[model samples]
Target: MTKPLPLALFGHPSMARRAWPLALIVALHIGFFLLLRDGLLNRIVPELPSTIVTAIIFPPAEPPARPVAASPAPKPPGPAVRTIIKPRPAVRRTPPVVMPPDAAPVSAAPAPSPIAELPPAAAPAPAVPPQPAARPVHRATVTSGVQYVRPPRPDYPAQSKRIGEEGRVVLRVLVNEKGEAERVEIQTSSGHARLDEAAREAVQHAQFRPHMEDGEPVTVFAIVPITFRLDQ
Candidate 1:
């Protein structure tokens, strides 16, 4: 007899109906996974230019330094040249003329007679007037002859008196040729400006006899001492 064909080749009728839904579910899952993978692959970014990126991020390198040339030293100066001067020849002097021994001596010529001289005319004497005698010059030291026509005494400063400021003020007075005090300078201070100024004013107002030199009035400087005593 011939071998029978297997019955498994022909599927069961009830199992076929249940297998259709499971197969459909598997196909739908495979299609959804393929769509997701394709979308992720499309979103991937390309690589950037490395050279442009590096230039923007980092600074450029500096160039190498160049070598410098040295300066040349100056040369020393040469020795100076010597010069020789020639001496000039000496000048000769001519000798004076000399007389010969054989020549005869010459005689001198005779002088002519002098004309007769007339008597000199007499000149009349000029009349002379008697000259007045010179006046004697008398010089006297000013120590005793000086007389004051106006004697001024400084008024005691009320402030100085109240303060009991007592001292001597020496002043230098310049008396002119007119016997008037022309200027007054303070020689020594009385420790008070007011007292010193008062003394100067008094001396300026006073009149004095000018010093006599050769009987002529002359300007002189005299020291006048003023005593400022509060008690007196």
Candidate 2:
């Protein structure tokens, strides 16, 4: 071994010893940085050459579309067929025959002569007849049961206050030989009890002439339509 060097710096032994270790660490770090830089550049730079960057281009577009062809017009229908109709044969007519004229002349026959006149004789006198006088005649008279007939009374409620305010009431009645109403029935309603009742009362008290048949008083069945109407 070489003679041991003096480990003193400016008379400081601790400073000299610290300086060597620090220098050795700084040298190792510098060497590692240079080696990393060289390796990274060598790998990446070779693949990335100096190439020109250009945008992609597309194919040219087709021209604008043309109009579609139209269908052909339909042909006209064929001409209509002609029909010839034959006429019927005419009827045959015969001409009338003419007769020849007569050659001889025609003559008329003569009339007979008149007779001679004679003298007149005397006539007798005519008898006169008397005319009879005309007799007096009597004519028969016809009468109707309706001439003296009266209407029947109406059967309605007595408590009803409204009188002729309602409509008319019609009643059908039959008359007997005694000139009295044999039967009475309402033919129609007056739409009010009072008016109907009043009509019935009147019909009950009504008088009538007896109906006659074959020159004698007889009971007659007749339809008497009595109307109960308001005065107004």
Candidate 3:
């Protein structure tokens, strides 16, 4: 006896129903696609008109020709030429003949006098008396005496306590005829304010001998230097 197939293994009837609708739809779609493809091909391709079919006629090829001649070969170079020359020595020429001396000299005419020797120079006019030379004027040079301090001060700030510092300062002072200081300039700094100030003060107070030029007083510039050392 043949074994009957199990109901569970057999496909459902609903699947069969779905398969029929899908098959129908696919068939219809295929027919529609074929019609659309045919219509597109007909629209895009143009119909060719009737024309005479002529054989492709290539122009007759020209007969092979002979190559043109290359320009005539350049003429062979001319033979190298040789020239012959003879050398001759140079000859020097002598100058023409000249007349001998012994010829008489020619005399020139004398010139007439203009004023008979210029009137003897007029006796040079009486010699003028010589004037005395003016006295020489001399410019005065004022000189300043050297300052001598009884006690020497230290050169360092810590050593000179009284002046608060110690250093050397050079001052240029203009002394007038009256022996007074007209202007004072610090020529060199002492590196210490106190020391420089002291030097200036001393110079102002110092007396000067008026410079005399031609026995007259004149103003002049003088340079004064002051030193501050320890032990003052």
Candidate 4:
């Protein structure tokens, strides 16, 4: 006779106003199941030092490869030292003093010539002015007298006379023992890059005349050609 609990139905005010919205929906589902079992549920994560998290995610194991020392066995060749060179005892030559025919005529005054230690005269080397002979560089494929005193007035490239672009250009000139044009080499190329660069700028501004043979001024390689004759 003592089991009448259900709060005795709140003493029945219509069964406590119908159990008060099922006791406020069972106390709001037991306070949201104890606030989701005490915030977000079942999470005991504070124990991470598994050996400092396996020493920061596993990297401590490479110390075992130091054993390579076996190289000392090569000493078996010691028996070849026989140097006995001793054959120099035959130089005793002193037997020619038979001067008894007078021996008194040895005062000719020429015995004082031993003062001849002459090795100090080396200062006359400034007279080296005789080197004028290396002037024969002859590659003149018959360059007549190698004449052109600045005759390369090439300005004809009005795009090579409006593209007529003629031919000749030979050039290989290097003619320079002071007669200038010391280098201009396109031996025969006037198929026309503006008549071969206007005959290589008229043999590099041509001033030749240095290719003589017995009259001296040498350094030749001439072979000049250069026509480009669009009728001129």
Candidate 5:
């Protein structure tokens, strides 16, 4: 019990060599204060120098533009689509038959002479001879007269005998079958057309003596009265 003083202080070799150099100087001062508290906790407060706090976040104010709703006025174009063209069927053009390049065959005009196509046998019915039953004959008169054979006497138009212009003209002559005076007619108008054209050129150069009738020289009509008198 009393032998436990460090085993009696190491059994006392001068107090065990001064207690082993004072326990190796308190264990080298507790290992140099635990390496200066792990070099002042590894001098780490300098980590506070990492506070570069540039926090300038200014971006949040854009929400005031909601007024865009006026787009609805385009609806008025609805009735124009008529494409109906159907009329193409009339092509009957057949007129091209002209084959005459001269092979010498155009001789068909000689058939018109078959004795002039023989239609002339119908001319034998022209023998009509029965027309003579109503007569009371015996008419020879120019007032029962006519006998001149060239009597032409009328020359008074020296401007109607110097304008005294007298009148009487009747005329109407016709007389032909070769007895002459063929047609002279003023049947009565002598208010003087130069004394009715000098009494129709003196009864057309007069020459009349032909009124025979059944013995044939008949063409008659003769009323003559010509007189333009300037005292002569």
Candidate 6:
């Protein structure tokens, strides 16, 4: 049980002291090296290279077009719509009437006239008398019973005398109230127009005594005959 004595590792106290310095230096160097290794692992970690695949994208091809259907025919135009305009009624405007200030008023019944109603009516005029109608004059034929103031003397036509036309012509002569021959007509033809015309002309220029009825002269028809003789 005595106090223990110190053991010498380096075989000397001085050697041990010097060995402690060397150990400290080695510890410091190991610590610095471990720190550098940790820093290099954090800064430079290897990453795998990514594959560079360049994909080319082309648009898909368009589908084929379908055929178009035919269009329908256009509809026909409808009848036109007409807009009728009615005329407005006319207005009649009459002007107001104005009467004159100085016009005289008319009475319903007029006053009676005393002068027209005072006198009596005149007596009716006397009735007139009627006269009788006159009678119609009588007529007769006097072939040879009448007297002649100037007898008819016919001159034979030169052409008839040359042709030897001979015939007798009877004439109906009208004798007037003045005892003169008014009209002459051929009662019987002479077989020749020239002979008959000559006899009619001669009788027209002659005068006759008028027929008598109760001693008064009257109008009558007288027949006269003329002869054209080729020997005379």
TM-score of 1: 0.38
Candidate 2 on 34-86: residue-level lDDT in tens?
87777965765576567899999998999999998998989999999989888
The lDDT leader among the candidates is: 6
Candidate 5 lDDT, 1-232, residue by residue in tens: 1222374647867877777777777778888799777887457444554567687989999999999999999999999999999999999999987878886666666545445355656656777799998665443336435677888689997877886888888887878778887678887887867778887998898888877776988677778787878998
On residues 1-232, what C-alpha lDDT tens digit does candidate 6 reach at each position?
A: 2232344656877777777778678777887788677886456665667999999999998998998898999999999999999998888888976668887765579767677556777899998887677758777788677798888889999999998899999888888998888889899998999999999999988888778889999899998989999887
What order do you get sorting by TM-score, best first?
A: 6, 1, 3, 2, 5, 4
- Inter-residue clash pairs, candidate 3: 153-229, 153-230, 154-229, 154-230
Comparing 1 and 2 by TM-score, which wins?
A: 1
Segments in model 2 whose C-alpha atoms lie over 4 Å from true places: 1-145, 149-164
What lDDT is reached at residue 165 by model 2? 61
Worst 10 residues of 4 by lDDT: 44-53
What's each prediction's TM-score? 0.38, 0.30, 0.32, 0.20, 0.21, 0.47
Q: What is candidate 6's TM-score against the reference?
A: 0.47
Candidate with top TM-score is 6
Give residue 93's error in model 2 in angstroms: 99
Query: lDDT (0-100) at residue 5 of candidate 5?
Result: 38
Clashes of each: 0, 6, 4, 0, 0, 0
What is the TM-score (0 to 1) of candidate 3?
Answer: 0.32
With candidate 6 superimposed using the best TM-score fit, by how many Å does residue 152's alpha carbon deviate from the native? 0.7
RMSD of 6: 32.4
List where candidate 3 sits over 4 angstroms from the true fold. Answer: 1-164
lDDT of 3 by residue, 1-232 (tens): 3243344544876665656667677778887799777897566677788899889989999999999989988899999888867777777778875656876655787887676555555566788899999856544333455332232232334445754665678888877767777777888998877678777777876667776666877667777777876655
In candidate 4, stretches whose alpha carbon ends up further than 4 angstroms from where it belongs are: 1-137, 140-151, 159-161, 164-170, 174-186, 193-201, 209-216, 222-232
Point out where model 6 deviates above 4 Å: 1-132
> Against the true structure, candidate 6 has what lDDT?
0.84
